[model samples]
Target: MTDAATRLATLAEEALGAPLPLRIRAWDRSETGPPGTPVLILRNRRALRRMLWKPGELGLARAWVAGDLEIEGDLYEALDQLAGLLWERDDEPAAGRPARLVTAWKAARDPRVRHAVRDLVALAGPGLPPAPPREEAGSTRGPLHTLRRDKQAISHHYDVGNDFYELVLGPSMVYSCAYWDRPDAALEDAQHAKLDLVCRKLALEPGQRLLDVGCGWGSMVLHAARAYGVRAVGITLSEEQASYARKRIADAGLTEKVEIRVQDYREIDDGPYDAISSIGMAEHVGSVRYAEYTGILHRLLAPGGRLLNHQIARRPEPDEEAYHVDEFIDRYVFPDGELAPVGRTVSQLEEAGFEVRDVEAIREHYALTLRRWVANLERSWPEAVRLTSPGRARVWRLYMAACALSFERNRIGVNQILAVRTPEGGASGLPLRTRDWRG
Candidate 1:
């Protein structure tokens, strides 16, 4: 009789028509596949059953989250090897579900794959489908990106314990990508440089007003107030973030210079701010509401004021309607987040009545930043698992690792877009050599 590990690999290959890139270690202490590759550890039969029920990325994610599947050896290498088969190998504009269904339907009719499926079902054993991990996001409460639904989404992602965040973010506490002068610069320096660069681009001056939308833990607001002498207001939906930011402001004795509000961007009516910085926040605005979001920022800024929008961008699909959010990301990471191409975002900003000045791609910087975050989490592994659950920690590890690879491969990117609310005469208030501000 075939050993469990060998049988699992053989059956999967029979269905895939290609060899798996890694080894597998089964719960029965059986091992198979390439000798030097990372081991995909099946800790129990439940992992197979989870995959059987869901049958794709979500099932794989659920198994990992439930502590039933484990990765041994180099995690990044393992993911990179599997990328061809599982993620980030799109050959064309998203074919959408109909095309995928056609492919699946054809595969289901293949006799070899049918035989493999039967064996896999028997291997998974007899049981009800496993419950999804508790950490997964539940169904939306209202219309997508509605104020109520958005709030819930933000809370789900950001309200994970502050201490846990502190462990990952370190002392600087900035959630977005750090600006790096050298590839090996410390995380703190990189983060400070990022904040300073944003300040310089906006030309912050003493007594000027600055608004930071979707401010996580008030890092940008505090940096602006402390370094540029600007009065800053930071808003977020997470009560935990608001409370933490308020305390940081008070501790830094910046209460007079900075204010942290538990508020929504849509609810904010105070306008004519000298500058606005929306960092890593626009993704949650959703494609449906992004124009409204950009327009709101445009309306809030005073004439000649600048807005620095830092955001992640996905490759634009030829058929935009075919672009589907990643199921693992939607359920386990950012619930309502939607990444748009940088071109689309710039167009939307222009439509919202801003004169776009410059667009800088910092794709590599984010890859570096995520690598640092993963290192931080790993170094504090015992505490991180204690602070959150093992499942939540696993979710972060997997998502961050996968994202780092995505940025490296240019499958995704991050950009800092600088635009101005030009006045009647149309001056952007920018220097002729604006590139110097990036440093």
Candidate 2:
């Protein structure tokens, strides 16, 4: 084996408590191979030593960004291992009571840090009320617009600059997987197919009206209007997004068919649509009102109409540390957002009188998506930095990196659920074979 491989073998053995199992191939230091390879590939022992020494969060993060360290196999798994490396307990003595006192002292000095710490702590703490007000917005935004306020939290990170997003998310701004149910398809093709797949799952038809909840920049709206021949109404709380989506719809010459309102889903007046889709939006629906929130969608959809709820989900375990990081997302990237497990989601849907028809776990798909996004972000960082703040760049990196790790470790997941309401006073008479999407 080459010397670089030899050093990597040693580091892998130490980190994993076993020798490396697979053959290692060092690339041209450019991180430019498959879509989801390691962050970087080190060529020599010194570089590996340097990465091991400056072992703070940012340093290791930069090492990945700079293409100094690398991994193979699942990208998300690699990231989880890397994250664990940051907090690894080395030879340093564990301080007992003094550490607790120091932590208390630090918490007392900075309320912001204390809040952050508390959020993490609460995830692991005892059960609390279902719908506690997120601390980010204190009594100011009010209940009527609480959802809007949370939507703004999601918009903050996404609306930084269209160009930045374009670089990372690509032309579609899909924000979700491409539905690679079939092999040998390209990413763009898979994305378009996924959009079509959603439309088909909803069984959308020409002239049918559809409502898209939490439509980001209106990709699905435009797609449905153009491809499925459906009139689409999408609601978003982001001013920037609404404006852009409207312009895109107008430019597409489908102004009559597609309209996006800069309003909360609760305020959406054009209801009784034939179909409903909430892609990447359920995360923002606080757990306190999962039932009521879904009931609202059921009421909004016409009888027998389908509702597609796409969301990221947590595992069944009551993991508090996981919740802490999730709370961080609410505070920073997605204000007022809450992630629910599959059981909670299905229960809420069932309570809303909707029969769950299908559910698919796109965990690895999301990992691949985030991995590509991070890579695109890194590739375009130089140009991207000129357009946005350094903090913004760091936030994107950390958020996407953490997300990649989340999916890689199976700590989180993405689910696309198709549900339909019964037509009569009770269950719908529709055939189970009606679930087929041949059309």
Candidate 3:
């Protein structure tokens, strides 16, 4: 191995206190670590420079997204092993901050270190380049959660391309946590089951009005209108999604029964619907606006109407009051997205004057859902890259796989909460027993 490559291998071994779990192949074709392990190939010196300068997940992510780094084996498994080692290393006590700073200063003076540091500093900060080229970084402006900003955020994410989403989401086009009847159920079937589950929970009957807030491509609305005979109105911020949904609804011959609008949830005024379903959209609603969101839903639903709020929640420690995702996600994936604890979400629901009837945690289902998406993306990688930029494709691949790992580890959760706006002495309009919607 070259001297630089050898030094890097030695540094990694010392940092982890063991031989690296994965093999490393430097740009010069020099290899290190076990032969059979997943291989992390550094394409150039810039890869190592990026990692050393930023020194965390963001750095590694930038290297991967920039095509400076590539993994030759199971990415998820590699990440798992790396994460375990990092966690274990973090748990061990380290030198004080001042001592670490002094060490860093001393190391910064080395020729290789100085070169990387100068290059990184010359770029004017640690942040990655603005996205759509090397990354899919979100650049939304305006006040957070405002109608305009929400539209910007939603459009940036969902407007990537319909064909691209189809490759990832499959034929069902359901983007939320699917309800898997069996551990081996197909993704399409599971997605259908999840849609029907929401409809059954709403107890839709003929001629009832259903408002699907933050609906993506009208999966739930289409299912409800076609199967449950409900008049459904699905709203989304992405014009692309609304256009595609309208086409799908018309093609399905449900044009008369379903309406797809390019409108924000906060902009919908004609409401008092019998039921509302907010699937996979609450994460985008910052915690600061949780109350406003729940209140808006409450105002829209008629008395005795049901609201099915499906969202991703954070699983915090018993005494912890906060949960946060990585900075990379905030920039590249779901910008301004916030995952509130289930307790806080339920409290918001109750405080909005709705009776919280049920809160079902289905985190494992989400893990399955994300894995299926990652598999689909991998299978259609070439087509996905054709439909969107390479950077955007990489964003989805990395974020979804990482999120699947997080869900499996109980670091996050997906919950379907059923609430009802009950009038004085009125029933919740739900059956006492949960019906088998899959039937």
lDDT (Cα) of model 3: 0.80
lDDT tens digits by residue: candidate 1, 259-343: 9889999989998899999999999999999989999999999999999999999998888888899899999999988999999
Question: Number of clashes in every candidate structure?
Answer: 0, 3, 0
For the record, the alpha-carbon RMSD of candidate 1 to the native fold, in angstroms, is 3.0
State each model's CA lDDT, in order. 0.90, 0.66, 0.80
Cα deviation in Å at residue 290, candidate 3?
Answer: 0.9
In the range 1-439, model 3's lDDT, one tens digit per residue, is: 3544455666554343356667888888878777778888888777766666556666677777878888889899877656644331222235221112123334665665465456434422345442323455546676778877777777778888899999999998888999998778999999998998899888888899999988899899999999999999998888998998999999999999999988777888998999999999999989778899999999999999999999998755554554445666877777788887899899999999999988899999999999999999999899998998787888899889989998998878999998999988877666666544221
lDDT of 2: 0.66
RMSD of 3: 4.9
Q: Lowest summed-lDDT stretch of 10 residues in model 1?
A: 96-105
TM-score rank, highest first? 1, 3, 2
Q: Per-residue CA lDDT of candidate 2, range 1-439, in tens?
A: 3244444444444334433333444432322323444434554333333333343443344444434444456555555444443432221234221122123323344554455344433322344222221222233256622665666565665667776777778888777766775544466777787788889888889999999998888999999999889999988877777887888899899999998887777776567989999999878777666776798899899888889898899866455445433433544466566777888899889988998888888888877777777888888888776777554565677678788777876778899998987688766534567657744
* Clash pairs for candidate 2: 40-69, 123-320, 422-428
Q: Report the alpha-carbon TM-score of model 1 versus the true structure.
A: 0.96
**lDDT of model 3 at position 244:** 88
- Model 2 spans with C-alpha error above 4 angstroms: 1-78, 85-148, 181-185, 319-327, 425-431
